[model samples]
Target: MENENWKNIRVPRVSSIEKCVAEFDITQLDVPSGRFRIRIYENTNGKFMGFTNLKIKNLFDGYPEGGVGNGNSITEALEDTIKNFMENLSENRILNDSDFIFVNYNEF
Candidate 1:
């Protein structure tokens, strides 16, 4: 949906991401009614080495609850943020930007 306020960008899906996203022990934070979950994955090698972060932002209030940190809601916010980051990285020839050194959550 291209518009005057913002341009549209497309991201080619990566099949290999399944393995990476699965490896991370997800750390999620959410306020009472707010809906958002951020997942960070660290790799020993590859482009997503240091810190591979994924965020799912909920656009509405209907986000379902799954366990303590699991939210059944599937929000596009999380996907949209990571997609933009990856696209820019690909353009800059940054095949290994996620390999940044370990640090606290605030640093990420």
Candidate 2:
């Protein structure tokens, strides 16, 4: 079955954001004229691990854009997110909403 076929697929696992940043392709999938969403979550062990994750989403559908960024701080995380977002956009891995890019910050 098509569902079973997916189970047999072996995808490479990235243990850290550093690895993702190193392997990300710097290509723009489309014009950066559309809007997207940025969700930030503070890592509980962020200070200890020195990293955090950032999620980018499509405002229209509220679905993630498949681009996660790891950074040393909130600002750094955002920078990384944008960098990865651009690459994902070029690869057509992310969708454009052209509506608005919402920024949600949750206090932890």
Give lDDT tens digits, candidate 1, residues 1-108: 232212222348832331123223333232222222244332222222223333222224423212112212222323444444344334433223232222334533
lDDT of 2 at 106: 39
lDDT of 2 at 11: 48
Residue 66's lDDT in candidate 1: 23
Query: On a 0 to 100 scale, what is the lDDT of residue 100 in model 2?
Result: 22
**Poorly placed runs, candidate 1 (over 4 Å):** 1-74, 92-103
Q: Report the lDDT of model 2 for residue 36.
A: 40
Return the TM-score for candidate 2, rounded to 2 decimals.
0.39
Per-model C-alpha RMSD: 18.7, 14.7
Best by TM-score: 2
Model 1 TM-score?
0.25
